[model samples]
Target: MKKLLLSILSIISLNVFAQPDVKFNITSDWGTGYCANINITPDQGYDDWEMVIKAPGGINSLWGANSVPIGGGEYKITPSPWKIPIATPFEIGFCGGGSSSDIEIISQSFTPTVTEVISEEIWIGENSSAYLNTGKEYYMVGINKDEPEASLHVGTNTSATSTSIVIETEGSDNAEINFQSGTGVSELNFQNGDLSDISSLTFSKNDNGATMSFYDKINSEEVIKVVDGSLYSREVVVQTDAFPDYVFSSDYNLASLSEVEASIDSLGHLPGVPAAEQVEEEGMSLSQITTIQMEKIEELTLYLIQQQKEIEALKKELNNLKK
Candidate 1:
């Protein structure tokens, strides 16, 4: 099967350098029809089928949104109304119904006859540092080709359940990487790779019958949460192949989510963007803490009884002295 690179870039500063003779195939569907508007979601190595046009020079003004529109071809190109001096990549896509089901990208890079990187790197801008920070906010909608899969690499912390993924900020939430299956997805993986520095994961599957597997790599612990009922951080739950079946670790890191939420470094805006911040704690630990607490109470009770006996002996000694 071929992979589709969907790039919905933020409309702004970013230099896209495309190699000459880069072939991309794209099919478009605007369910809402033409004249409908859409916004761009930007990403690096973020390839997709869309057109981006500028002020005919660099990043000046959007020339004509109506002029450069994608029709059909195996070649994926970012259209810029600006000068075509240097080989550049542009970000723009069809927006309608807010559903990406319509826009699909097919790459020629993959073939039984050949092999290459199925990726397209996008530059933040002329200045490399201009890219969005780890804490910076961005919207996302997962696409299910069949089995849903997502991967996020945080230089430090990363966590996920069957239905959600929470990325950590730099030193807290560094980077948010995701991969979703198209329509028929049933699994999510980081390709045996690792994701770190993630704060929280918020996942939803409208189709209840479909199954999803969420993978998290935090603190060298690889947790696999089959989304059907309860997970460690069960914010969004999806019914799995096992109905009424749920499993959670006897031990949970209560501070993990809070640590992630506090790390959303979106320039300090969107105060608590990480949904994990809103998850309600299950009060005292029933599986782990309760047992430990019970044991400690028993030990304390025994110690108290011994102390009481010692006091009685002291009282008897006092009477002997008086006599």
Candidate 2:
């Protein structure tokens, strides 16, 4: 009976995020609509792919190939926060699969069909979003044709280190990130990525520095981990010798906008207050949440154990009957 109950709970929990909607054929709460999620309705070849990320009046696009299949099909991506989907200042994959060598966008705030960013990106109308901080890095997966470089200046004002962390688990011993030291702020962005593909991630921070990490390519939520004291650490995403299934598409509430805007001059976030914010109130620690989850797991384990005992007793009764 306990095992049966556990199985039922597990099935119900899977729908917390990745619920399939047949109309869009996309797996997710998609609780909110998309900025623009489109694939090639035309003839698309292996060498045709373009994704655009526009913020306010600014536009940026990455070009690539073999991004999407030729025909139409439903796909699940790491939970992407449409615009500023993650902690750092980075845009998720555009996922606009077509036979176009050029990809751009405008800041007009509502351009759905146009592949490039126009002067006024239609996606971002009048929203007063913030920009990427001084040193945080964003992600871009799939078609790596146009890997854009950051026009960042890491010097006297603030320190910055930018690098791309790809989870090609098949060729590496580990898929992890470790930020040793620094002051102002440090962050990591996983644009077009997936957590399953990554076996583990080891995150650490020292002193008064704060690290804002976003794995947009992960098919879940944007995890903004903070560390204020002298010691902070996390287990790295683990990856064995096999290539695991990666689905990117999750829910994310922005971390902090004001501070982010003041820090990253390049990153641009949504206008209104994010529905979910990760700001420290009077008294709240991530440890407490972890403890709660641990307790729940413990309860589940205990329940399962009791059920196992019941099963054993049932077997014994059956044996006696036979005798």
Best by TM-score: 1
Per-residue alpha-carbon lDDT of model 1 for 58-148, expressed as tens digits?
Answer: 1212322334333332223343434222223433333233233333334322111001222223225543333222221532223332212
**Least well predicted 10-residue stretch by lDDT in candidate 2:** 106-115
Model 1: ten consecutive residues of lowest lDDT: 110-119
- Which candidate should be chosen as best, given lDDT against the real structure? 1
TM-score of each: 0.20, 0.17
Q: CA lDDT of 26 in candidate 1?
A: 24
- Runs in model 1 deviating more than 4 A are 1-173, 186-204, 207-229, 232-288, 296-323
**Local distance difference test scores for all models:** 0.36, 0.34
Across 50-91, the per-residue lDDT of candidate 2 in tens digits comes to: 333222221122222113222223222222223321212222
